[model samples]
Target: MGKKKVSALVLATTMVLLSACNVNMGGGDTASKPADAASKPAGSSSSAPQKVVFWHAMGGSNTKVVDQMVSDFNASQNKIQVEAVYQGSYDDLLSKLKTSMGSSDGPSIVQMYEIGSRFMIDSKTITPMQNFIDSEKWDVSQLEPNIAGYYTFGGKLYSMPFNTSNPILYYNKDLFKAAGLDPAKPPKTYEELKAAADAITKTGKATGANFAIYGWFIEQFFANQGSDYVNNGNGRTSQATESLVNNEAGVKTLAWWKDLIDTKAANNLGRKTDDSKKAFSAGQVGMILESTASLKGLVDSAAGKFEVGTGFLPKPADAKEGGVVVGGASLWMMNNKPNEEQKAAWEFIKFLTSPKEQAYWHINTGYFPITKKAYDEDSVKDNLKKFPQFQTAIDQLHQTKLNTATQGAVMGVFPEARQIVEGAIEEVLNNKKSPKDALDAAAKEITTKIQQYNKTVK
Candidate 1:
């Protein structure tokens, strides 16, 4: 059989098995561990009604909201409980999962970034959520088809969506006013952005703009041009592993980035700090490309003195404005445990991603809502009037092509791939090499690593 057909068959079987097992998927008062499974005593049970442990990286004021959600879930339920744990950022969570999987103790549910999808699949340490959906005969219709595409492997959902976000253009109104440009208007195309950057730089208000991470920015750039960052977003669409980073689209995007740095309209800082955040916050940058997750931070840091506006990520002059990919993370269920623990984990997953849960998360954390129902919620609709930047994500999602590239980038060695690509961007900015040559070198190195990964995985 062909690779695609083989993968499809595998997915179909998993779904069939999942549907055969009858289970109550959503967490509620009646859903609990079987009597024999509830052998341990509860610790520090608060008023909130069964406490499943949830480890995530969403910290700061947003973490409080997660706790509140737990409290509310517990109060609403008499059987299953949720315990929220703030476990560092996405990278930290991956490392901790590695350690926890080796031992007996691990959180029932863990938060994972888009890249984690590969590791979770390789380890076979995560429960395919499609199983839970089928087992309980849950209404999958409530979730969008594309949302499942990001978390699925071999045709099954391995994780539930949570705290999802997308990239957008954040322009400084104060800079626009000083540049004699319309404060309400943001650059809608790459050509317009370059002109705006030059105009804004001439005003001496601040630098042109900053990108949080050059590689991620480049990925968005090509995505907007309808090019895949990595082989059709890691074969989620097809099994091809080709690299188009040296193509005309990629070369054009890379050259534009180099020009921005060469003209002194922008500065190249590694993704070490909130490059854009610090630049925009300190009034050193007039614009930035950043994740929608940073909306709250920008608003809070600006202190209402500066006007912050957001727009869809711009595309190349000739490209049909493709949409940006989603950021943030998802909830992954760990394997290597009893079915009862998995059952409990699935319950928490559903609870964390339900319409009510997603609405609360989007509003509280500034992450984009993963479900369409959240958009229908009056609370979310009302918030859009006050913080319209939040709606930029919705607009982008609608325009997005729903393909691998715009859905998300998939690379088994993504963390390493990013490091190499960033190094190339730096080389171009420093005049050490032309954008084409620099990316060519980086691509060669990355291709070697990709081959190594294929060998290892095979």
Candidate 2:
């Protein structure tokens, strides 16, 4: 599916460059630590503690949680000293990581987005977390199965799921009541949603709805309708060779959304979720769909203004009922570090996944706790009581039927493919092209990229 075959001369030249870089990619600055130390973690008697460089993309409000977690881990340990560095957004962090691949200045552990799984495994720049888990005989049953299921492929966990979230219908309950609609009973299907939006817009105060034109939401819609984004069982069984986004479910999803815009039921607030969130919090829009990670922030923003409420993601009436996929990033151990350093990094990871730490993270941020035991913590119990709205997503995740569609698609070129899908969506929304045609075009482009990506890995 690649657009064109590369000439042998060019391919060989690129290989030669990679070969030169590969020779020096996994060494240098490993620090001085005794490899023979039998006892480590917090009780090592070794004079020089193993140094670990951890690069993460967590920013804004959640930054303090990560900082506190890392600080506590370091203070509690004598064998490992971890330096956690904030590395911009997920995309920026990935770009910088690729640039630092051949240098010794790279991190021992890094946080990467979920879509980058195939690329990370193909790059061979990191060690699979499964390897460490096997050696340590770690019991992983405490972790949430659905979340872990997304990260596991071919019986291997490439990374540790840190923060997890799912999309939900966030609505202004006060606006719903003002519009004479029942705030307690939100719409569950596409047709029902349009009716509610129309009702809300008829009121003079606010528009009916305004969801961002994000590709992640599109993918969720596909799952909600029991549709696959790619072939080969959503790329779980094998490397997907083509995209299947222009199918019946996809066309209907776009058509219904565009109809909302055309009917003046929903506002086209551009592609930024922030814009839509602003409108929702200001009572300018009645409803929006966003990840549960925005729950705490939205609750605070709408405080003393409009009441906030949540519902399950809406689907097409005729479509089979499905569930939402987990969103957020995971932690990976880099292979560039020494074995001792890698071992120390695992200790820090375990510390973060502990019931106490997971509870702290869940209460402070809107993301779900990775371990089930975190719910038993008094902090989580108290926080949930205060903001019961968070329970909507928890119930949604629990109700989801675990299947290929809900598990999400995988590919080495996912980030690029998302951009292409967004372009197609923009075309559909702006009337530049019909939904089918736009998606068909984007599918062709993404297919070529996927093929080319597979070629490089082979």
Candidate 3:
């Protein structure tokens, strides 16, 4: 690629304020297109585009892939520079955004998880993407149905969906064979899964299976059952105003989870996600309910030592698994910046969320592509055929519903609520509390939080 240039006009207005350091863009510029660099403003620069600081929480190989995308975007244009800074985990990024934005020292762009959507929506410090969409006349329909709803809030678009993933069932085929089960036939329902787990355990070949993030798993379960976990149309119509976790449907879901744990069909395995994964890799667990994003790590960790099979999460008896909610995170445009800076941020956001970039990101990060066009591409399909794990997630994607719960949950204190739910689940699993009691307590705690958040936001 030829050297891209940066516009002097953009450089004069844009400043990258990340960490405690200040990076200034000199008036002297290079001739580069806006698409070339991510961290820099896109007008035209002759020298290499100035870096636009991107605060992100992606780590491991996923981080490398994001950095590669930044590089790819940089090489494609000359007007702007994109600087991707690893900002620890999701919580770390949230902390940084909350603390730094008040001082105009936060990153221009940051990655926010799905759970953080409500928090961002409540914060007046974000530049809603709706304005940019209107200005650029970009097609929102180009995004994949399963993911598009996640970035939308109360009819306004605030973030760009980038890394999207869903929960899936990962089973060990060798364990299946030992239990006289067909490796090709994975469980389609909760009942079937229980039977499989029982048979696998009967052979005394492995420890019982486990699910990572039981709360997330349960949320998908409720969404599949057409049950709402909160009021206000599950927060799609209005912000969540009440708790639904203690309702009949939710009670049934919790009961089933309790039974799963009680029967030893699945272990509670508190959320050291990697430990549960390690158990699976060591052939100590026959089945694992893990995020689709963990597929890459599981595959690599197994290293051909076990036959791995991935499938959609099992459905409840009365309802088919409708749509697995999108997990992972998104990119938000920070407010408090000048109009020119916001425009430059919009350009970078557009480039990052483009179909081409989404496809590459999906392949590299093992997350689903956020655009249907990317998944429908010949290359993507061919790769899926070759890699069955990838195909399993794609199949699940097509079967999703776009309602609030399945589309994505929205609540002001979602992360806090999730932590509360996680603790309750742990208590129930450890036999310290009944499922009903545990969830009831969590529900009450979350409801108070929801009301508090509503009051605060209002």
**Candidate maximizing TM-score:** 2
What value of lDDT does candidate 2 attain over all alpha carbons?
A: 0.82
Question: In candidate 3, which residue ranges exceed 4 Å CA deviation?
Answer: 1-51, 376-379
**How many times do residue backbones clash in model 1?**
8
Ordered from best to worst lDDT, the candidate numbers read: 2, 3, 1
Model 3, 37-113: lDDT tens digits are 24334454445444466888888777898889888877887766788899877756666666675566787778887
Q: Identify the candidate with maximal lDDT.
A: 2
lDDT of each: 0.69, 0.82, 0.72
lDDT of 1 by residue, 195-288 (tens): 8888888887788877755566677787788777767554566433555677777788778877887787776776654766788888888888
lDDT of 2 by residue, 108-160 (tens): 89998777777676666777788778876788888888788888888777799
The per-candidate count of clashes, in order, stands at 8, 0, 33
Worst 10 residues of 2 by lDDT: 1-10
The C-alpha RMSD in Å for every predicted model, in order, reads: 8.3, 5.0, 8.5
Ranking by TM-score: 2, 3, 1
Q: Give the per-residue Cα lDDT of candidate 3 at 249.
A: 58
